[model samples]
Target: MELTDNDRSIATFTMLAHAVVHWFELAIPIFLVVWLDAFEVSVAVVGVVVALGYVPFGLGALPAGLLADRYGPKRLVVLCLAGTSVSFVTLAVATSIYAVAASLLCWGILASIYHPAGLALISTGVEDRGTVFAWHGIAGNVGIALGPFATATLLLVLEWRLVAVALAVPGLLATLYGLRLQFDPTAGLEGDSESDTNADGDTGSRAGSAFVSNSRTLFASSFLLVFAVVTFVGLYYRGVLTYLPELLGGLPAMEGIEPPAGLEELSLGDYVYVGLLVAGMAGQYAAGKLTSRVAVARGLVAVFVGLAILAVAFVPVSAMGLAAIVLYCVVLGFSLFAIEPFYQEAVAVYTPPESRGLSYGYTYLGMFGLGSLSIAFGGVLLDRATVGVFFGTLSILALIGAGLSVRLLTGPSPTDTEVPEPTAADD
Candidate 1:
């Protein structure tokens, strides 16, 4: 399906924003290797430092969603990109762990804007929402995979500091480019007549009342179960990526590989880590296609179960041979991202279109904010325990997510069906 000019404009802007967000995000793990040595910190210490950034990145989404409503998705998207650029530049210059932590926190706060703003914009603006969602997820996974690969590649020639500054360039360019593009943010929803947004015109008290009301209404429905699924998936997504390269480094396949001349901070694990996420791009596309065709809850259960089985096999697979390990990485990456579209659509199925911004805001709030613990927790495990324990925990976590999906599938029909649509007078 071809997107019209307006849809293309909006979709392209959101896609760019999504990609840049993950670009800075996943790159941190690659830098974790450098930080571990340069700052002389333990895995737990460094993990906490990075979580300082990610926690806000997730936690701030609710406010970011509100701000996106008061202002606009386009404006917030620009701030997210530009602020993230500055934050990375800050990270590049940091001389202490404290400075690094502060930079990450700043980045998180700004990057937090992307999900609520971007997804809301898409649900409202794009004519072909499902296709755009697929493309958006694929673009994000590209940034996800490329971040580490780009950082690792640049580090081969330049210092990590230079690489950081270099990474900031594309985002800045993207922000500027985003500024000049314009489209009606609600083009797709123009005919719907019923929605929970007065957002741009919302007064302080009215907005708060709406927030409380919406929260009450959403939670009273199946959205709560949807939220639970993401919280668990969030753990799998953040925990695994946070320490994956280091975990891969311990494998026999990653042994005996040396960095190029004068490059002591590089690791062979980074490339394999990137390859796994690159595989996720395919998963993202596939899941996007599946979201509209399948029972979202049922499909998600299968994906999470795949994640559980893969997590259990991760350590054992590395012991088999390089070919087996490579195959495992592909399947694992595929399963990891495959859950995204299914759950994203699940958010829609369980909530109203009016509170789109707030719904997605809370969605990310659970996924990223609460999910940041996985990073800290994984760091602690890697620092204090064995690889088997870490992967075993992730397997258990994925099973928990699978259970949540099962509940969602068998629970009452979508709660969105129960809500009465608000008219203009309700606004």
Candidate 2:
């Protein structure tokens, strides 16, 4: 693969956009504690509220993907970011749990477009897909780390409403800048620039047939297997991350947790939560590179098994004192996201270039859609059962994902047709 101006531009734009997507997505967890107190709701009820937003974040991807295929990624991406910013502004003014739910609903619907639009843009547009995916994952991890850090930091000074408004700022600016970026969405396809759907002039009455046909094409192959893996990944992801910050904040940690002389709201647990996400940058980069070198299923199997162990071990490890907790956080954080690049690569391998957007649609539908239920499930657990039960459940999920990944070992080796090699420029 060769690099071009378009690759650089698209890669840069999508990477930044990916980070912003996660910036908002992950920060919501940080707000959970505050919402629980402010709204005076039970954990189970709050979980349902958050899920209302999250479910659509996944479910909307089907239509968003179709729209991406119909219009183009850039326009939908613009709407996603811009609309999310507006939704967050609404959140800032929210007076009740109902208002917050409405705000999240808007955010979910708008932010939902990103995975399909952005991932499809990169898969079909960037020549060196793996390299860009590495960068993309790294950027998203940064957002995951920073969004919470920013939220926590701001909460120390401003009210939660103000923090919401402040966090919305960068996304709006990113939308403005991304709106001006120009790149060829099909530059990575080399000579085969036109997609089959576009070539056939798919529209209106044919949309239903296109969806059924596209979905069939995906499920007919190993894409179904890839989808299953991602679904499990989503389950673990939402289950753990949704409450991690608040969970960590409650941990009895060492000297680092105490606020400095002037700072009031700072704590070591916040650092631990953020650090775990920061560690994921390394995992994401490594796994993204690994995709070019190894079979994705084998890697996913190893990663999922590791996650199961970590899930079972997390509560015990935190008991050993602050250092052990931090170490656990680092490893847990790294393991949390390591599966992403591989599964992303898997999706690309099992699917075609033409339905790329729809493939990612199903991809996120499994991830965000069904995965949102775990929030409620976890909430119920936290409300009724011990933390031990919660971790044990997470362990089961990881093992199931591992079991699914084991089947992919029978697939053929990589080729130019499967995982695309990283370009020299990427290195």
- Models 1 onward score TM values of 0.84, 0.83
Worst 10 residues of 2 by lDDT: 417-426
lDDT of 1 by residue, 278-359 (tens): 7888888888788767888999899998998988888878889777877888888888988888888787667666666777
lDDT of 2: 0.81
C-alpha lDDT of all candidate models, in order: 0.82, 0.81
Best by lDDT: 1
Superposed Cα RMSD, model 2: 6.1
For candidate 2, write residues 289-339 as lDDT tens digits: 788788888899999999999999978887899889888989988888888
